[model samples]
Target: MEMKNNTVEVNHIRKAYGNRAVVNDLSFVVKPGEIFGLIGPNGAGKTTTIRMMMDIIKPDSGEVKILGETLTEGAKNNIGYLPEERGLYKKLSVIDSIIYFASLKGVDAKTAGKRAEELLKRVDMIGHRQKKIEELSRGMGQIIQVIVTIIHSPQLIILDEPTASLDPVNAQLLKEIMLDLRKQGKTVIMSTHRMNEIEEMCDRILMINKGRLVLYGDIPSIKAKYRNNSVLIEFQGELGEIPGVTEKRPHDHAVELMLDNKTTPQMVLETLVHKRINVNRFELSTPSLNEIFIKVAGDERE
Candidate 1:
């Protein structure tokens, strides 16, 4: 199947087993060169939804379009997927394992070999190319898995917990690779629970809770939608004497204040000046994705 700019379009998909529905009328689109996130708590049907998208399991209802065509045998070659489950031969050498997986995706031996070496180097695993998978650390194995996923240079890349076992430094490296892929015009679908990763890497997000779509949109807009209209202040002097400050929470390097109903930020600044509270900085606080996720997902559980 020939590929199109619309890498993925899931329309009202429903998946059920026995008497229970796992996914209920889920619909979303992943545009070209965009990093889209599918996030939810455990048992939220995230894995099932991704499986349906990859055609590993058929959905009970609705449609999934990949590269503007219904997912099929030929369509698989145009997509790359790193499943949550790790699948690697423990006895196989790093280079051989990557080549083996790449070959399954229709990559030629020579091309796969060359690409494997390049990817290993890119991920800083070239020095261990000849080492057995069993000899490598969990983080090293995860890097190899990522290499295998992108060996064919698929138009759409789907990664499930891509950095789950990686250290902070390696996790940041993988994130950079994802951004580089986007720069090359490849669409990426990232499924992870790390709110910070979604905030920094994803262009848009689809948040599912208990198989239902709870939130979907660009990051900034979503944050703005849930903002509490509060201000954050950093001061050297005492803030307890400020009469207008109704509530305060001490953060690592600053304090977050909840202003009174009638008090404006200007009034708070004036009060600080009058009290000589050596104000260093004052800014409006926006709701973080983590906060929004907890609020939206947690409230539903109640």
Candidate 2:
């Protein structure tokens, strides 16, 4: 339980329903003051894992140490969580709902009121402060849930699909708030399907598939390891088969060349030129996070 400097430590955790294991021997660590991404495809048991970590449910095996201690009533005060599903009192006014959630975390009514005002303003929802939760749009409701999640300014925040309902502008606003939290040295665990957001905001990522870890490490290293194995080329003339190119995919007017183990980008470029292919553009490129996600998770039909 004494995880010294780590904020979260999930060790060999396993969960099952009947004979099917949803999460199998999963283990990962989240460092303090960093944005950590928990990512996987639909039904990959991401929410189940998060539920176990939050103590909303228990793992069938192994342990979860949160903030260096076993989760307890007092420990819950230091954590904030936004479930994937929206849960708000529809009859309650926006301000009242915020205040109620804050109060549950030991925030005084008056102080919670002031913080609610600031948060509402920050999210550009101050005008809807007195409206009932049922009266707001889906996007507006998502923002309210976020306000409720962080009303107490907890040290560790866990968000599941935090931007699911927002428009581009509102999603950008939420992303900004997340960045601000990182600046404040708060540990954030974000589980979202948006790979662009994950790549942009997370310091490290733990990618899971079928409830097991597929990739876990700092973003740059993972990208370097998986991305540099290919190159992009745009040529005008007829393309000839190039040696050392293991796979080729036509991308628009260009081609993406996946190199073999011993082939480098420089070698490929030299071969293209030597073969008299009129190259328009030849550049080394890295695969996007989305591409990597698909490659690792694979097709469900498969």
Candidate 3:
């Protein structure tokens, strides 16, 4: 298929079961050649939103646009999806299963076989191409599923926890693959609980909480949006009686001080100098995605 600027536009999609709403008026845009992440704690409607985008499940209300059109059977063929749940047939050989899935996406046998060989080599699973699905480890099986998902070279890829069962090494390999896909101008939408992955891999993120959009923007902007303007200061000598220090969290090597209103970092530095404490590194602490997740998701997990 000839590639275009394959963007995903979700405009107020809603899915509910009876009186409960699993996804409520969620909207976001994923641009082409970008790695966009849909992230939230479990049961926060991440899966429902992804399913609706893929047309796997019809939304109770609202629409999903993929590649500039309403999602349909043809649109689906342009997507490579790896769901969180494993779906490989244990009875089939790994290469056979991969080819089968590629064929479903309209790839011919010859092209599928060639691409499967290359992908297996890329994933360092070339030797196990003929192995049965049941013989491979859980991590290996996950890798095979990922290969199957992208065999057809779809313009848009959707991965749900793509590294669920893999070790750190394999997980890193998957991250590299995702980056390669983006370099090839493919739009990727990945859902993962790994905040580190989202931080390192995604260009933009959409955070959903209680089935509603809590945050959506570029990573730096999102982090900046939640920044508390707190700074961490490490001092050797006793620097007691600081006026601006509202609260202090003592770590083994440093202390993170929450400043009081109208207090400046320069003031803290001057106080440390006046106290004659051996000051070490001083830097602002930006909120991580994990912290942002907690702050936005609230105590719902409890």
Task: Work out the TM-score per prediction.
Answer: 0.87, 0.91, 0.93
Compose the digit string of candidate 1's lDDT tens values, residues 1-302: 34445779999999998978899999999988899999998889999999999999999999999988898887898889999987799999988888888888889889999988888888877899999999998888888888889999999999988988889988988999999999998999999999999988999999998888999989999988887756898889666666667788889899888878788778878888888888788988898899999999889999
RMSD (CA, Å), each prediction: 3.1, 2.5, 2.2
Any idea what lDDT model 2 has? 0.91
Quick one: RMSD of model 2? 2.5
- Candidate 1 pairs with clashing backbones: none
Worst 10 residues of 1 by lDDT: 1-10
Best candidate according to lDDT: 2
What candidate 2 gets wrong by more than 4 Å, as runs, is 1-4, 236-241, 246-248, 272-279, 299-302
When 1 and 2 are scored with lDDT, the better candidate is 2
What would the TM-score be for candidate 1 when compared with the true structure?
0.87
Task: For residues 1-302, write the lDDT of model 2, one tens digit per residue.
Answer: 33257999999999999999999999999998899999999989999999999999999999998988879988898899999986799999999999999889989999999999999999888999999999999888898999999999999999999988789988998999999999998999999999999999999999888888889999988888778678899888877688999888889878999899899999998898898988988888887889889988885327
Clashes of 3: 0
